[model samples]
Target: MLKDLSPQAFFMGLLTAFVGFASSFAVVLQGLKGVGASDAQAASGLMALSISMGLCAIVLSFSTRLPVSIAWSTPGAALLVSAGAAVGGFNAAVGAFIVCAILIVIAGLFKPLGRAVAAIPAPLANAMLAGVLVGLCYAPVKAVSFNPAFGLPIVLAWLVVGAWKRLYAVPAALIAFAGVLAFGVDIPEGAFASWAQSLGPTVLLVKPEFHLASIVSIGLPLFIVTMASQNIPGIAVLKVNQYEPNPGPLFATTGLFSLFSAPFGGHAVNLAAITAAMCAGEDAHPDPARRYWAAVIAGIGYVVFGLLAGAVTGFVALAPPVLIQAVAGLALVGAFSGSAFAALKEPETREAAAVTFIVTASGVTFAGISGAFWGLLAGGLAMGLARVARR
Candidate 1:
């Protein structure tokens, strides 16, 4: 079945995995801060999430006979970074995880929330997505300015693959990486060569401690952000790709996974958009029935990468900052354009979408929650009120 797919499809899947992994490296630091995790504990969290996501993707793909990619909730990480700082360190963050898990479980059982979100107008959803992705595009351009030597190669690679659309799925990230090596980018001296580093490592695990203050301060906000920012768009991605897996099961699985890993400082887990798109694309497998393997492959790769957390961290540390920025920026360009275009498509909704985009892009925060949540709420409410007045 894998052999039957075009090379482009397989390469696309590989690219998807690479991008997902690379983009997520920054979150490790945030995750550590949220949980007050020791280096080993942090590594464990990374490993566990990767393994869970990979296993879930593999099982779901095989069971559903459709390509399905599962990924750690990126928005969840961002939410944690903001809210975790205020909470009582890692323990409080774990408490929030527990709350989010329970909420997800309840959401799965109820079905109404999922149904309503699914009912959202495509244009509105797209506008919200555009707003979400706009900030991401700036990273790469910024990276290039910071480190021209490293960033240039990544940009060149992007241009090369972009120009030759036939090589679109050829893991442009790998090419960029090659450019990094070819350019002789230097790493900071003695970054990790310290006696503090222990060779024989004991896996550290965290126990969830519930506190009222922490739950209100951290848990509630994280839960709201994860649902509003991540899961809603995740469902939209699945729908847009025309793969209608049962939302209940998907939500339930992610919730359960989060529940299991929360004590160890893992954040919310959910579907991936960009990575999933790779698997869902016609390039992966013309016969959609077989495309699930691509996700399965990606999931497995995620686990492998996760286990190498130390190595991953070291590599990212050595990587020129400009390169990171450039890669992130390039990757987000399509997403940003698609989102902005969607946000303005409807005359009636244009004003609301614009409001959402501006507010979200402005990066405002109230009580630890990000502008993305408020922007969507503000826009959605305005649209709803306007419709009501029309009636």
Candidate 2:
């Protein structure tokens, strides 16, 4: 197996990890904080997610000899941002994460359940995702209003870099945000010393507290988005590159890892979508069979990066809240645009999709259920009535 490894594969693996970790970690932090996680807890969640997904990728890729990348569900984190804190706060959110992970496992183990989830209309799913992301998408603009001196640079960095090389855009914004934090924002004395002190990896277990409202509001929607936005696309990316691993086992493995990480405040770890391309593509290696090495190496990179979560979280926390949010918003713009475009593409479902998007963007909460659930329900009803009318 060592004979199969190449320098190109190694480089691509490290690049995959860098891009994956740098791109949307702020979203993970923000989402954890949104769900009532203290800074220490959010740091723990980030570390847990990073390590879990890293290990997951290593195990799957090494065992199957496929470039199976793994990642936290960025969309699920965004959903948490919109869903707000659950009735029982962060512990309840942890319980919801466990429920979502278990659902993924069940879907993987039971073909019927998997098929049922797969049968959800793509337009509705995409619309719901689009809705959840709309608020965050506005962060870049809002950041500018909060302080153009600080935020403009971040937005411009993303725009200029994205126009040149779309893949590096978010990381560029992340760098710009870092610069703003270091030079533009004033940090309290000794904060750097404290952050340095907290540089090492640490885990904090959050005892789960299950509540019906949390399960309905956060868990179900989280499961849906993770499957639709990340897991399915990850499988498709592998297939696109001519690797056909059984989707069931991969899903189950990711779910198990996610389950393990949940008590540490991690939301969901699943097959990666964007980073999957990096490890699975020709850039990783010319020989398709050898690409798995890239994924394995990337897994190692993620673990190393995970160790720094405490420092990263601490540094970002010192900046104005809007600044980190701007970076996260920049990271998600591509996803939001893609989902919105896909959701509205089919003429037959366009209206229903629109309805779903509107309801989700409204951020409505009814009977302790989030807009995501209600939006899906409303869109499903709209499509059902349309079908009946056509009949």
Candidate 3:
């Protein structure tokens, strides 16, 4: 096992954790807030997610012997931004999250439900994930335009390191981004000290309130997106890399963890898409069998990061939100490119995939449901029509 501990895999794992968290962690916070979580609840949510997903990653990786990295459902969080507000308030949102979690657990345990989700055409799944990421990929460009002095240099660092060592590009960009935050950003007085005072993990329970409207309007849609957009694609990502692990427990694990964390401000935890590639891809380890360690180390990194999340949240408050988004975009370019390729690769599903891509990327929401769900809806309709015409 120790022989597998190469610097390449270790650093790549670290990079995976850093990029994964930095990318859209702000969205997690925003979604929690939109759902009506108090500032304290939001901090608690972040901490719980880091710990929950961390343990999940460690458990799945060791048990399956595959590089299975779990993540908060970013798209699910995106749903919360609009749905949380629409459905009522934060407590209502917590109720919706609980319902969604129960549904995810059900989907995982039932063989027919798992098969149905797995049956989502590969092209459409890839396209939906690509669409979700493409919008995020633009953050660095926006960052540069918004703050060239900082963003431009980070881009240069990423490009240079990417050219030199492809695996390290995102990590280098992250390091540069962190340096800028460390030295350049104006952190408010006593932010660190105040955060330090509350260094220990705190779980804030929002006793879930069940409402029928919320269950249909918020919970069902949230489950669909998490399963379709995050978990399904996450499995696809690992499969394409030639790592096939049982999906049942993987889904069940994340669902249960999401359920556990919902009261504490965490939104949803599912299989990771972009960052999973970082740990499972060739860059993580030349020998695919050894790549699981990358994920295990990533779990460790998450645990440490979660412990320090209180301080990080304080700094996040002190900094410009856009910059954080920009850094996240930089981290995700590789994943974006990979998903795009997979989405466009097959001719049979090409048109349907394009529909999925466009609808998801458009960020259109309806009836408190996100574009991801609609993207699948639109793409599925188009795909079904195409199949009928062919038949």
Q: For each candidate, what is the lDDT?
A: 0.64, 0.94, 0.78
Superior by TM-score: candidate 1 or candidate 3: 3
Clashing pairs for model 1 are 9-283, 9-284, 35-90, 130-339, 139-325, 140-325, 140-326, 140-329, 143-322
Instruction: Give lDDT tens digits, candidate 2, residues 1-391.
Output: 9998999999999999999999989999988998889999999999999999999999999999999999999999999899987889999999999999999999899989888888999999999999999999999999999999999999999999999999999999998998988898989999899888888876899999999999999999999999999999999999999988899999999999999999999999999999999999999999999999999999999898888999889888889888898898889999999999999999999999999999999999998889999999999999999999999
Local accuracy of candidate 1 as per-residue lDDT tens digits, 203-272: 4577777776667655654565556556666667767767777778777777787787676667677777
Count of clashes, each model: 9, 0, 1
Candidate 3 or 1, higher lDDT: 3
Cα distance off (Å), candidate 2, residue 15: 0.3
RMSD of each: 4.7, 0.7, 3.9
Worst 10 residues of 1 by lDDT: 194-203
Q: Whole-model lDDT, candidate 3?
A: 0.78
Total clashes in model 3, counting residue pairs 3 or more apart in sequence or in different chains: 1
* Candidate 1 colliding pairs, count: 9
Cα misplacement distance, residue 106 of candidate 3 (Å): 1.7
Rank list by TM-score: 2, 3, 1
